[model samples]
Target: MAEKLFGTDGIRGTVNKGAIRPDMFLRFGEALGYTLRKAGDRPVVVIGRDTRASGLILQSAIVSGLLNAGADVALVDVLPTPALGWLTVQNGAAAGLMITASHNPFHDNGVKVFGPAGYKLSGAQQDEIEAIIQDPGFDCTVPAERFGRVVDAEFDVSSYADFAVRTAGPDVSLSGLKVVIDAANGAGVSAAEPVFRSLGAEVIMLADVPDGVNINTKCGALHPEGLSEVVRANSANVGIAFDGDADRILVVDENGEVADGDQIMGAIAIDAKAQGRLAGDTVVATIMSNLGLEGALSREGIKLERTKVGDRYVVERLREGGFSIGGEQSGHVVLADHVTTGDAIIAAIAVLSIMVREGKKASEVLSVFEPVPQLLENVRYQSDDPLSAETVKARIESVSENLGDSGRVVVRKSGTEPLIRVMVEAYEREYAERAVNEIIAEILKADGQ
Candidate 1:
């Protein structure tokens, strides 16, 4: 049978809409509970959510379904997705659920499932759950008194903060630097401030207050203009912005310039290499990573391996190749030795620690690699037709040949949207812009309007 609900991340949509409605989420919980019970006995499932207004309602529906299927539920309120993943494995639970739309707008919501290993559910496991959800013969009912009880658990954000501080090693501390943290009014607001304060940095916070409807609304990594202003206003050493789920982070230098994932990864990689901690002298990144990053690492005799776009794919490559570091350009960094998933707070701490130890400015410390000129344009389509039209394909090929060794082009259809993303990277800004525009024009033509 073909899968219908799950995406590359999990089940997601505009809340109260197709497949993400309350009834569907309830059914999903039941299917997940049943699958876990069949694998073991009276399995425990830990659940967490971001600050989206729909989170509580969805949490209630999911908990009801899990309890009816005889699975004990631990409701961890208002925690980051990675924290839930950590708690799931730490408590030896059978699975975990996080109610979040991640970087999506507040109007959207999602349910992400993590297996016993604390990683996202694999394709086979997700398929099994979908099968159970679809089967007419599968029973989702449970008798009264047999229904599992829900327990409200206090999640200690301080524990994660302590862990992040410790990971910077004994020799590092941000004792005197002034820093600003923008929490995107999402999950990190609770922990990020304390963590920086504990490390002795002067902390200024913005967008940390979540009104349930404000999470990721013109703030956080997707919209960092406010963060830039905050940094400039305070003359802070640096600024950090976390997404709605707090699994990713982007940096802004004291000069109010945005520093993306490539810059962050390059900074960390150089430090690791110097400390002899970068395993096999290699770092794993997605294909979307700027070519400048690869060139920078090459200068230091370090290798860059490209994986697919997902952080999971990057992590899988890291493990398979025995590399210690990997991340995406979107700022989802994974230090396998530290945490199971991306922890934005932890990542920022690591970067700041480097600054402290080196006795350098945040801009100086983070500017380990220079980025090439890159441009990304998304072309929306009227229909969900395939983007491999002869005209579009020919244009891409021609652009690639024209750029030759001086640059590269990547044209891909977005996984979650009916759009084609045309990206180009070149040594010259004008060339990159022209190359991307050519491909975009062709894609627009292929859309038949």
Candidate 2:
């Protein structure tokens, strides 16, 4: 069997390791270039990267491969993932690639491919590229005369910032809002501060200094505890934290309470429904979304559709249903009306707009629903197929039967990492904790951990 390269997001792993190495990235770029060349002659492929030191090396190698395979390259230098996607569509490129591991540590890196419309690649497209990369006999060389040229397109980042500010509409302004933005020391540092300040916001930057290795060390959406504290210390109206690539966000309220994607989506859905802007009166989220979100939307006469655990799946379902809003609990909110992928800055703008419109504190508007007690535990595994173990399966089944309809258990392997995510939600915190602990014990035992 062939090795799988694409994950729920994209091709990601530790930098200089496995398929993330420069040599493999060069071939990966060749595969992508070949695929694009088949669609158009000397197709343009827009490329950008986050603030990791490895980004430059990987970018050089990939650009060499793309040029070698007869694809013109528009290098955007350092830009957020969403900005790169937006630029790809604006530049009429055949495809786009953003090099960053998102919320992962700086030593990690990735390549997220976007189609012409700035959406993620479909399964069929991924397969085509993977086949070319895995085939040892595949030829990637092209005639020197047919080689493509490279162009400096770094100035286009401002265009993306303008588009992001426009997502909140012309009437929206952040004049009185004091925003604490945690840029994860990544690509967002370049755009987030400028966009917010342009709208008259008093922007306080946090974790904004990127020293290559400090991208997500103790900051960003994944580690927003510090963001919450800073918000309180500064008495800011709201705090927003972006991951390494600035694709997703987690907000902190005025009182320093962290708001995850579910809360953010709920607030957006409620506001959209009130404004009659919510298409189909629906919000699409992942199965990992809390039942509280469903109940809250239900009360508002809105339908909540659940997909698998990826933001891509959420976007797919939203498009299928023509829903205007969707995202994951992990801070990947895709506002289809504004973006094709999870654009953290745009989503933050939406939330801020809501606060401005309602004339309320971030604490008042962000907590749209009271989340039910939920516990998610990630268990690492070195063995293969721990879910297949009899003890683990039995424990899962037994827990399900015992919890019945009042609670639920969701256990699945992480697509991007070697671990199992076990989530349990119930009406009571103790019950949820106990159920999660039991499942973890069984999983660890099964994996011989």
Candidate 3:
């Protein structure tokens, strides 16, 4: 039997390899179609992709599978994952498929599914789809008359821009501010340009041209140094860098300092509390979030809840706890009251709104809390079986104890790689680095490296 392919987020790997191969994608689509058909009749699936060269091939294979399974497909050419999610529900589709690997390198790609409500499929739902994919007797055929039809919809840059503007409200506008945006040459390129321009800000764009291979080429959130340099060179008020799919955003202040998701959440949380708009006066973040962020929110009498690393988990916690805001430290902010998922465009608007309303620089507005030093290292193992090794567990426990209250340590196997992530955060950079290094050394020793 083929190995199970789905990861914590979705099936992701180097294009044409492992779970990301064309055949696998075709099978995945067929399985998805079968699952949706079992749930109801004549299900519709909306599809979108990033500007990757391999995206077209994967999309074609997926569409073929969906069509072969007797479903209708709506092709929304080159859109962000969140937009595809919103469009899925808006068009009453049974499922939405976004073709992009998010922050992964250019050679990699991924597929993430959304339910009819524009939310990601639950763990059980993914498992069911996987089961169907692995079933030998599952029907992969479709009737000629019932084959899916694909309709090309004009990309609605205005609709998303309008939604972002409305979310910011008419009272808030960045009339005289100058802002620089690095779209990572991915899904947000076209939409972010118009949205910022419409909001009355002088917009400067970098990495906005997507030639398929250039998406996230050392330019987006994963590499904000370029954006920071641009911000400093142009003396812009602020800078926003978005990942490949534009679901997450990293902000660069006027001083060209990077303000990560935790800082942004702190700023927004404090402001929301002051305005009495923070539901339950609480915010949700991942365990990877900085300790300073928790302290900052706590000082305001707002509760902070930590979940696992994925934004899906963060969103789940937010929904279950009735919280209005939550996100990952990587800038995947979810304003659940406004959008169903992490939206870089919406988060950018929120950050810009704070600047416009306060008449402050992005640096001034975003620096709501001082972040502690954090170090993260990913150690690849020779064999995947070693993650559950006894020595690794003992090392993790020992490191956790050493961290105590002065610092934090997290060591876990990567859901998508044959590696373990070693993360340490503390008030002092040296201590965090040493803690992470020691843990990595232990993992290396166990691996006989």
TM-score of each: 0.95, 0.98, 0.97
User: How accurate locally, in lDDT, is each candidate?
Assistant: 0.85, 0.91, 0.86
Candidate 1: segments with Cα more than 4 A from true spot:
1-3, 140-145, 152-155
Deviation in Å, model 1, residue 385 alpha carbon = 2.7
Among these predictions, the greatest lDDT belongs to: 2
- lDDT at position 287, candidate 1: 82
Clash pairs, model 2 backbone: none
Can you write out model 1's per-residue Cα lDDT over 1-449, one digit (the tens) per residue?
43377776788778876667888788888888888888876888999899999999999899988988989898777888888887788767889898998998899998888888888887788888888777857897677877878765444455656767788777777888889888999998867888888888999998988999999999999999999998998888999999999999999998999988888888988899999999999999988999889989999889999987777788778878888888989899888778777778888988898888788787897786778888998888885563768888888899999889998888887655556778899999999998888888887787887
- The number of clashing residue pairs in model 3 is 0
C-alpha lDDT of candidate 1 relative to the true structure: 0.85
| Residue 6, candidate 1: C-alpha displacement in angstroms | 1.9
lDDT of candidate 3 over 338-427, digit per residue (tens): 887899998889889988887888878887787788899989989646657687778778877876898888877777667788899887
Clashing pairs in 1: none
> TM-score of predicted model 3?
0.97
Model 2 per-residue lDDT tens digits across residues 1-449: 66688888888888767777888888988888888888888799999999999999889889998999999999988888989988989998889999888888888888899999999998888888889999978997689999989976644899999989888788988998899999999999879998999988999999988999999888999899999999999989999999998989999999999999999999999999999999999999999999999999999999999999998889889888888999999999999988889989999999999999999888888878899899999999989889999999999999999989998899999988888999999998999999999999999999888
